[model samples]
Target: MRALTVKQPWADAIAHGEKRIENRTRPIPPKHLGTTILIHAGATEDFNALPADMVRAWPKDVRAVVALATLAGCHKAAKPRCCAPWGFPDTWHWELKDIRPIPHPPRPVRGQLGLWTVDDDTLAAVQRQISIERTSA
Candidate 1:
């Protein structure tokens, strides 16, 4: 599976909050649509974007995989403020669905810029957690 490293509150929003749209400069590649990807929280936090109270509620798990989500679809922001507060003008809104948070993050690992591939060991660890999640559900 592939992974995408996102900034603090945004990543948390996808995992535990009600953020279904991820605003990016580019759209998700056609091939990756509908693929399940890991949501990794980068080391840096974007305090300027989200409110302080919202950020405080999110788990501070930097450089860690927070959730598994499906890259459901992508669409350009046709209007100035199309997708509510999360959407930005002139950016592609990558739709995320079926978000499943990893209760216990696997071993901490560095993140990359875009939709990067995860190593076999890291994939295995994430798989284990997903298995547990399924059985519990």
Candidate 2:
């Protein structure tokens, strides 16, 4: 299983299905996609100006929560334009469907991107139930 580390609120939004875009680079090529991916809810640099669509769908009780979500699909945000740049677009959008709050993740790192492989035990730790108490702190 390949786990992806994502920033804060976006991770939370993904967990609740409010946000579809991971808002960063693709962890790996579309082919490298393995059996499952873990959603690492770490901190993000910017305060999302949050789009209108996001605000409408965002869980009302949500507060800077981080969650682990399984990947469903990865697609381009829009048609790739010709005049952009040398490399792929700065943003590689991902769809987060099966999302759950990861209570405690090991080596919880903070960054915009990184895809690493994890074993069964780590997977179990991620799948463990989270006590969703209180609103965002």
Candidate 3:
């Protein structure tokens, strides 16, 4: 499965279903739109970008796949502060849907810059978690 490496609190926010819009400097590729991808929390943290309360509450699960979400659509900000605190002006906002948090994260994997393909072992691990999540739900 494809995956995207996002920095700290932001990745945690997505996993918790608190943030649905991912701000990026580039538009989403047409091929990737509407596709479900893993949300990998990178090793870095954007502490100042989020409020202190949120930061303290969110898990800093770096280098791990925390959730799976569909890239529903992508659009420019169109206005200043478009998607509230999550969206920023002059950036493409990637809308996410069907966000399923992986309650049991797999082993840590190295992250990449953009959308990337997960190795067979990692993909298998994530798939197992998804199966468990579905069964329990």
Candidate 4:
């Protein structure tokens, strides 16, 4: 599937489920299109953009975006995504049913909170959806 290449912490957050808003200069594509694979793109560029305050809070923690997802029909945010859930509780707050890790696990997921993908099969499904939506519009 098309990848969103999130940084370390943010990618970890999504994989683990701890962060809510995957803050970005460019917002995730609006929900107007068909379902796109929530790729936990591994760290690409170092998160030098992390605010000083955030760094102070999370000294070792890294930040990446694309972990946050809208529960398909529901707009409520699911639980934060990260191996370390920080100090927060891990609960399915939203209705996100299908979550697939496009690439192989950078690390163990601990538990399969959502669907996981490591190849083109699942990615194709999301890709098809994206293509359909793009053409529809």
| Models, CA RMSD each | 3.7, 8.5, 3.9, 11.8
The global C-alpha lDDT for each of the candidates, from Candidate 1 onward, is 0.83, 0.50, 0.83, 0.37
Q: Clashes in each model (backbone N, CA, C under 3 Å)?
A: 0, 1, 0, 14
Q: After superposition, how far is residue 62 of candidate 1 from its true place, in Å?
A: 0.3
For residues 16-120, write the lDDT of model 2, one tens digit per residue.
555655645554466644234556555543336445565465443222224655555665646554213312355666655556655555443433446666555
Residue 26 lDDT (model 4) = 32
How many clashes (backbone atoms < 3 Å, residues ≥3 apart in a chain or on different chains) does model 2 have?
1
Q: Residue 21 deviation, candidate 3, in Å? A: 0.7
Cα error of candidate 1 at position 63, Å: 0.2
Tens digit per residue, CA lDDT, model 1, 48-135: 6777787777776888899998888999997647888777789999998889999877658789988998777887888877752321
Q: Give TM-scores for every candidate, taking all chains together and pairing residue i with residue i.
A: 0.89, 0.53, 0.89, 0.35
RMSD of 4: 11.8
- Candidate 4 positional error at 100, Å: 5.1
The lDDT, on a scale of 0 to 1, for candidate 2 is 0.50
Tens digits of per-residue lDDT for model 3, 1-137: 78889988899889974899999999888888878888999888887877787778666788998998888999999864688878888999999988998877775788998889888898788887775232110
Error of 2 at 127 (Å): 4.0
Candidate 3 C-alpha RMSD relative to the actual structure = 3.9
